[model samples]
Target chain A: MTTQQLHEQILQKKSFLCVGLDPDLNKIPQHLLETEDPIFEFNKTIIDATHDLTVGYKPNTAFFEAYGIKGWVSLQKTISYINEKFPEIFTIADAKRGDIGNTSSMYAKAFFEDLNFDSVTVAPYMGKDSVEPFLAFENKHTIMLALTSNEGAFDFQTLETNGKELYKQVLETSKTWKNSHNLMYVVGATKAEYFTEIRKIVPDSFLLVPGIGAQGGSLSEVCKYGMNDKVGLLVNSARAIIYASNGTDFAEKAREEALKVQQEMKEIINSKF
Target chain B: MTTQQLHEQILQKKSFLCVGLDPDLNKIPQHLLETEDPIFEFNKTIIDATHDLTVGYKPNTAFFEAYGIKGWVSLQKTISYINEKFPEIFTIADAKRGDIGNTSSMYAKAFFEDLNFDSVTVAPYMGKDSVEPFLAFENKHTIMLALTSNEGAFDFQTLETNGKELYKQVLETSKTWKNSHNLMYVVGATKAEYFTEIRKIVPDSFLLVPGIGAQGGSLSEVCKYGMNDKVGLLVNSARAIIYASNGTDFAEKAREEALKVQQEMKEIINSKF
Candidate 1:
């Protein structure tokens, strides 16, 4: 998806909420488990209910990969379903993948061409060659992990290097990479304060902020610092919204939870711009 | 596989060579394309031919994933084939995977518990929660990307932080993580000099050294600096060995290439002690 298209979708939906479709077998509604593919069934229902309220859907590959081939089939089905039905909804393959030059190219082909995701999250430890292949795909965004929401983020991302933080260096060096216009960044909502520095580096670029609801990051704090003129913040809330209820009306409950966040996002955008 | 078991296998094979099985559709023999599953067929032949010579087999996941669901099925069959046929050899899933707490757990289950890989490569960008989950698996190895061979490794890995290199910080901090015993590292063979310092922090840990043959790093240089008292190194050679020939004698040619590396490794071990 192009930057203009993504921005238009955000405005049209009146929300920047990117619903995270990380469905766990044990966490989904018990009724869906009896179906041929419970994960897809859950994601399909969630997408159907909340597609209009959100601008994007991110299905973290780890959730699908845990079940082996059967899980991968469900993952393919979910992405296919979304692309066919909700074409406007930006899809992200939250597979934090990176490797050598040729190997990274294979990964680029996997998520972008084969599975057909608009974006894939990548780890930046390996640097340019690993990330360049992902950026090589046109209209496909490479969401490099800058400051992750996890505690592990502190291990290397925040370490001071040459008078700047590691994540800052990542944002700086990434700007020089090929096709960097398609680049996006993953800055955890937990580190809302860091957005001040992050926005200074890549003001126009989109930011995929995870760790809002379940991970205890405040949506208001994230929007205050991370939001750009185009409202360039895809604030993701997964477990808190999707697993809002374990009852039969799980999808409906998910919509209610998403709408609440969407309403908050709408207010944030209105107040900011 | 346990540390002792892997060490014994290394000693028994008289080589620390880890043959990389990364089969590409266009690169494999043309006749294999006529088979039911070309990728698996290629992998099966390679494994059958070179299983005895190498102590480990590292399957880069991107090569399989680029082909989609069928590719994933091929990966499942390949791993199952390795485990069933050559239980003695250590298997490394060269899937550079890492994520948040629960998500990382899912990846751990996917590779270790589900796919049954003896070890899986993880990117250290995410930090503690991302890596600790993989370490949670008993007798399973978590080979982390410390100093990669590619030019990108220069990006964030070698950056100076706290009066130490970033990769050095990773080594120092990783020692304090839970289940540090399960930890191995990926220090690229291209930078053999870094091994001197890396060995200081992680003297006993097995380093899965790549960038040996095709990537243009000598095995002698890597072993000189990388080897531990346990003869700790699983030096990988992928394209140089697997794509040795594309004819009917492809497997035989692969063995010839692997045998050459095996003999070199045998000499390294003999001369080192």
Candidate 2:
């Protein structure tokens, strides 16, 4: 998906929220467990409930992968459902996949061809061979990790080299990759201050910002430093939305939570326009 | 598996060969296509024939993911077969997953908990949040991509910052992550020249090196620069080894290729030790 299309969606919906589909089997409503595929059922209801309020849906691959084959099946079903039903909404396979050239090419086929996600989160650690393959696919974006929202994020991402943080170096270096125009990055919401510096490197590229809601990051703070001319921020709220409730009204609660963020995004986006 | 166990197996077999299970359906033996699961059948034969020579089996997840559910089922069967028969052999789920804290924890559960892989490849772009969750798993190693073998690898990986390559920064920064003692790295064989520099920062960590054989990387040069006191290199050969013969002798031919690499590895080990 192009940044322009994402910008259009944000304007149309008046929202910049990206709801994350991270359904934990144990945390999902008990009633869903009775279904043949509880994970997909849970995801479908949430996608249905909040599709209009958000510009994109980010499905964390690990949740689906945990159920083994069943989990993976659910993931495929959920993605197909989204693609078929809400064609305008961007879909991200939050897989963070990267490998050597041939191996990475196959990954490109898996997510872009077979499964048909609009983008897949990739790791930039293997340099460009593993990452550039993902970028080669037309219209597909590669979301590389920049600054993350974990205690250990300070371990390496914040380390200074040549008077610049490592994350800054990643952002600057990415600009040189082939088809890197499609490159976006993951900058966690918790590190709101870093966005100021990150913007200097990638002023226009979209940022898939997680760690809002459940991770205790302030949404307003993120927008203060990270907002671009296009409102280039995909703020994700996973557990805070997917697990909002564990009862029959689980989907409704998810919508309620999504609506709250969407409402806030509307204000933040309007202030910019 | 731990470096000690991997080392012992390498010494016992006199081989440092890691056969990559990048089972391309189009490249499998034609006769195997007649089976209930052609991919599984192809993998079974290859494992049976070359199990003695190889200390590790690295399955690139993209091949299985490409076929959807059927491919994943085959992967399960293949891994189960290996674990049941060759319990001592190391298994790597070359998945290269990375994400946020909560999301990454789930990925760790997917590979380490559900799939039972000894190690899984991870992208370090998301910083510690994406990487630390993988490290949190006991005895399971997180193989971060340090350097990769591909034309585009030069794009971002080699970019100089602070007079050091981005990959060098990744290696140095990764050392500070929690449970990093269990961490390994993926340094491409084609980038053998950088191995001497890589070794200076991470002399003790095991490296899962790809890009040999079909990738045209010289094994001798890699061994010369990449090997450490523990011979900490798991050199992977995929297409060249698995597709050595696309006939009934495919598996046998795979063994032949594995044996050749194993013999060379033995000589290298003998000369070094």
Candidate 3:
């Protein structure tokens, strides 16, 4: 989906919320395990329950991959379900994948072509050749990691490279790449102050913000600095929403959690616009 | 397999050659397409042909993931085949995956426990928390990217951070992680001189050197600079050997190419050790 279409969806729903579908067998409801494909079933219900309150679904590939082939099957089913039922909703494959040029093309093909995710997250360690392949695909977004939410983000990302931080260098270097308009960024919500600095590099580009709720990031703080004129922020909440309740009413409880975030986002949009 | 066991195998074979299993449907012989699992069939033949000459097999996950569920299944079968048949050979899941602490744990479980790879490649862009989980695994090796073979490696890796280059800081910081014994580094063959500096920080840690033939890296130069007392190198060649001949004699021709590399490695091992 184009950024314009994503912006339109944000306007219609009044929520830039992208519910992260990071389902784990141990954390999910016990009763769902009896089903043939518990992961898909859990995701199906959660997507159904919260689709109206969110603009997108970001499924971290590690959760599915941990279960082996069965997990991959569930991931495939979940993605297919989202695309078919809610065609307008943006989908993000939060698989932080990057390799050399040719190999990265294969990854771009897998996520964008085969799985049909609107975007896939990429690591910037390998630089331009690693990312340019994903950008080559028109309209299909490549959300590169700028500043992550985890404690590790400080290790190398914040370290100064040539006068500026490495991530700032990353954002600046990325804009010069071929077909960079398709670029988006993954900036952790915990660093609200960094958004002010981040905006200076890529003013119009969208930022997929994780680290709210469970990770101790404030939605309002992220909005205060991160939000652009188009509301270019996908504030993701995974564990705080998805694992709110593991009982039979898990989906309903998830909706409740999502609704809370959506209400906050709606208020923010109402005030801003 | 432990590093001790891997080093022994390298000594026994007189070749630290890691045959990279990157099967593409378009590149593999047309006749294999008739098989039920063409990717698996191709990998099986390659493993069967080159197992003796090589000490390890590094399957680049992108090639398998590109095919979707079938691709994953092929990957599973290929790894199982290598473990069951050539139990002596070390295995590297060339999946450069890293995420936040919990997510990285899931990926470590997927590649180390579920997939049973001896080692798995990880990108260090996210830093400590993202990598320490993989290092937490008992005997499994975590090969972090230092200086990659591609041109993009120059983008951020060579940039000065603190008093040293970013990649050097990666090597130095990685050594402080828990279970640093399991730590390895991916230093691309294209930059042989960088290996000299890399060796200063990680003298004994095994360096999984790619870019040998296809990427224009020299084995002798890498050995002169990178190789430690225990022969700490697993030089990888993917396309050069595997895609040697796409005809019916593909496996045999692949063996021939591997044999040439093995011969060169044998001479190096004999002279050095």
Candidate 4:
């Protein structure tokens, strides 16, 4: 989906909340383990429960991948389910994939074409050539990692380079790449203050914020500093919502968690826009 | 496999040549396209032909991922074929994956446990927590991207940071992480001179060098500056070796190309050790 379509969905739903589908077999309800495809079943229920409350579903590819070929199958089913059931919902393949130019093209094809995710997260360490391939796809978004929510974000991202943080350099340099209009960014919600600086570089670009809920990032703080006129912030909440209750009411409980975030997001949008 | 075993295999084979299994459907012989699993069939023939000449096999994951579920099945079969047939050969999943601590563990588990690769390449844009989980795996290696082979490497990796290059800081900081002995690095062979400086921070670590044949990096230049007592390098050549022929003689032609690189590697090992 295009950013404009995503913005329209945000306005229509009165929510910019992106539910993270990071289903872990060990963490899912014990009863679901008997099912043929537990991961997909879990995700299906979550999507069924929370689809209307959220504008997007960001599936962390790592969780599915950890299960092997079976995992890939479950992942395929999950994405297909989302697309077929909720075409308007933005799909983010939180794969964090990037490589050399030709290789990166293969990745772009895998996530954007094969799996049909609206956007895929990518690491910016490989630079322009690695990313431009993803950008080449019109309407498909390439969410490049600017400043991650993890502790490791400080390792290289925060390093001072040419009188500015490396991530700022990444944001500025990325704006110059070919087909950069399709670019979005992965800016962590853990550092809400950084959004002020991040917005300066890519003022209109969407920011997929991950770190709220279980990661201890404040929704209010992120909205205060990060939200734009289009509400260009996809604040993701994974564990806190998905694994809310490991019982039969897991999906219901997940909706409860999602509804809380959606309610907050609705308030933010109503007050701002 | 342990680095010691990898070094021993390099000695026994008389070549540290890592045959990069980046099988592209468009490039593989037309005859194989008619097969049940063309990617696996292509990889099997290549492995059968060159297993004796090369000490390691590095499968670039993007090539497999591009095909979706079928691609992952091919990858599983290819890796399984190698482990069962040639148990001693070191396997590198050139996935270039890294994420948050927990997520990185999932990736490490996927590659090291599920995929059963001896090592996996990772992007070091994220800091210590992102990589340490990969290092936590016993006897498995995590090859973090230091300086890549592509032109984009110059964008962020070579940028000045903390009075040293970002790549240098990556190498130095990586050494301090827990179980760092399992750590290796992806140092592209495009700029051979960078090896001399990389060695200062990580003299003993095995460096998986790409950009050898197709990307115009010199093996001799890399060996001169990068090699140590363990002959610490797995020089990869994918397209130049694998795509040597597009006819029925493809496997034979690939073997011939691998032999040429193997012979060059043999000469380097003989001169040094």
Report the first chain's TM-score for all candidates. Answer: 0.99, 0.98, 0.99, 0.99
Query: For every candidate structure, what is the RMSD over all alpha carbons to the true structure, in angstroms?
Result: 0.8, 2.6, 0.6, 0.7
Which ranges of candidate 4 are over 4 A from the true structure? Answer: none
Q: Model 4 chain A — which ten-residue stretch has the worst lDDT?
A: A222-231
Please, what is the TM-score per model?
Answer: 0.99, 0.92, 0.99, 0.99
Per-residue lDDT tens digits of candidate 3, residues B1-273? 899999999999999999999999999999999999999999999999999999999999999999999999999999999999998999999999999999999999999999999999999999999999999998899999988999999889999999799999989998988898999889999989887788888888999999998999999999999899999999999999999999999999999999999999999999989
Per-residue lDDT of candidate 1, residues B1-273 (tens digit): 798999998887888989998989999999999999999999999999999999899999999999999999999999999999899989999999999989999999999999999999999998989999999999999999899999999988999999999999998999999998899999999999888999999999999999988899988888778888999888999999999999999999999999999999888777766
lDDT (Cα, tens digit) per residue for candidate 4, span A14-89: 9999999988888999999999999999999999999999999999899988999999999999999999989999
Runs of candidate 3 exceeding 4 Å displacement: none
Q: After superposition, how far is residue B263 of candidate 2 from its true place, in Å?
A: 1.6
Minimal lDDT window, size 10, model 2 chain B:
B153-162
Which regions of candidate 2 fall more than 4 Å away from where they truly are? Answer: A1-3, A161-163, B151-169, B193-201, B270-273
Best by lDDT: 3
Kept native contacts, as fractions per model, are: 0.97, 0.69, 0.85, 0.87
Q: What is the C-alpha lDDT of each candidate?
A: 0.93, 0.87, 0.95, 0.93
CA displacement after TM-score superposition, residue A25 of candidate 3 (Å): 0.6
Per-candidate chain B TM:
0.99, 0.98, 0.99, 0.99
Q: Kindly provide the TM-score of model 2 when superposed on the true structure, using C-alpha atoms.
A: 0.92
Model 3 docking tier (incorrect/acceptable/medium/high): high
Model 4 per-residue lDDT tens digits across residues B38-87? 99999999999999999999999999999999999999999999999999
Summing lDDT over every window of 10 consecutive residues in candidate 2 chain A, give the lowest-scoring window: A153-162
